[model samples]
Target: MIRKFLLAALLASATTAQAHEVWIERDGTGPARIYLGEPGEPVPEGGDPEFAKLKAPKLINHNGAALVRKAGYLEVAVPAGDVRAWDDAVFEPWGEAGKKESVVYYARAGRSETRAAMPFEIAPVTAHGDRFVVLRDGKPVAGARVTVITPDKWSKGFIADASGVLRVPVREKGRYLLSATQKDEGAIAHPSGTLAALHRIATTSFVVE
Candidate 1:
């Protein structure tokens, strides 16, 4: 019974980490910040352990840019073009005994730039950021779950259609952040070890007028 209880606790921790979302947001005419937490919530001063595992994410368009560690998030320069960020440094095993697997996270900041830019991406379908398509490896990830966070801290959940397109209910005019995730069970080798699953997380942020 004690072993079972410990197993349950481990699984619960893994689920909490997986449920966290990563996104990048920029205020008007300011530098972009990469945040990890539930949308609209205040980030902790030291950040979560999972968040600390992330080294610096690569800015797709701005290759040589630097990431400055802030109090609770990482800041980066936003160039004229659309901003996108990708990271896979959080490589560690999670889950209990028989179901153990490792996960890697990928994030994006802007609209669809290219497949090479972000392996997993949420591309805007409409001119505004209300509609999006979830893509993995350049292919549509149908039935993907997407969480939308409005400027006022309001949040809603939506699922992608057969074509991977999803429409978000945008009510006000401010910054919107959308997060989507996809999982692949194929095995692959990494410096950390052999990864049994690939967890792809994509987020796109935009301002609506």
Candidate 2:
């Protein structure tokens, strides 16, 4: 009988400690309860650091109706060590009172996929410079063709290697635009006899001086 009574008391205490509540007040006007749950429980914060970063939807009061504004969204991924440095990035509107609105967002750091961008140096070489490799998702894109066009109508072309990288020679030092295109043959074909599918294209521009 004593053991049964002790177990009942322990269970009641545990239940009370597990109960928790979270809420947001409307401009500090009154106590408005938003959520209620137990502590140490996981919740979806709405930010993914793996593939891309997006702004969290904001809650607003427009003439007593809740309106959401999703403009002014910025997406960027920095190095792992510089994650905390983004805290100082101002997220609020700067000018014009009528254009300003409250902001709400969530951040995720220390993810494994975060890395630095590739660095390239441009200098005047001979009629053509050494070739460089390009990879997407760490794999070569074979059969991909790269083209470079200069301001004087000069152009050169190269094909990507098995590793998805292409090194082409650039003749003449001036503003140049580089573009690549690759088509997937296995894509679903449309009935109109014209290929209607997705193609991967990457383009970059640099000034050779």
Candidate 3:
């Protein structure tokens, strides 16, 4: 009971940090599009302002794929593979007036890959399964909080166990988004300026059929 309470509290604290995330979506034989917004929310004409902030991320599992600007997302040329995206260009101070922090974003398209390819990543436990592991610097991040958005926009939060693994309950046959946030202490010196705390938000998307 105490453990569950602690997990719930952690998830609650990440509400604002995980409010919006970068996710990738790709249907069969379709272009892999990277979107910046809340899952299930309507994107604006050119995506949210934050979307504009997205420079090219260090894409894994594919090479030489250009990010084409679109009305609401960035389109990739890759048709398959893990096709993950990790961008630290958004490493700027964010938040209201005095309490801002340096934030970075990582995203992944849930393919049949079980290896961690980003500094912070959410990878499948098996070639085919709802079980996922949250990793930071190639290591499991125990107690990490994960929030999942389903096809119907229904959502739920879960805490990674000691092994940094969590099984998502898949009840529908459609796309799903999973997000997690990790906070680190200390200030950071960026070319832009000095940043307060550091926060990393990672999101993964997959289609379940």
The 10-residue segment with the lowest total lDDT in model 3: 90-99
Error of 1 at 37 (Å): 1.9
What's the ranking of the predictions by lDDT, best on top?
3, 1, 2
lDDT of each: 0.72, 0.32, 0.79
Q: Which candidate has the top score in lDDT?
A: 3
List the candidate 1 regions with Cα displacement exceeding 4 Å: 1-9, 45-50, 96-99, 112-116
Task: Tell me the spans in candidate 2 whose CA falls farther than 4 Å from its real position.
Answer: 1-130, 185-196
Q: For model 2, state the Cα shift of residue 76 in Å.
A: 15
Tens digits of lDDT, candidate 2, 120-149: 111112222444444344444555676655
lDDT of 1 at 98: 45
What overall lDDT, based on C-alpha atoms, would model 3 receive against the true structure? 0.79
As a whole number from 0 to 100, the lDDT of residue 99 in candidate 2 is 26
Candidate 3's TM-score reads 0.82
Colliding residue pairs in candidate 2: 134-165, 140-163, 140-164, 141-164
lDDT of 1 by residue, 50-79 (tens): 677666777776878889987668888767
TM-score of 1: 0.82
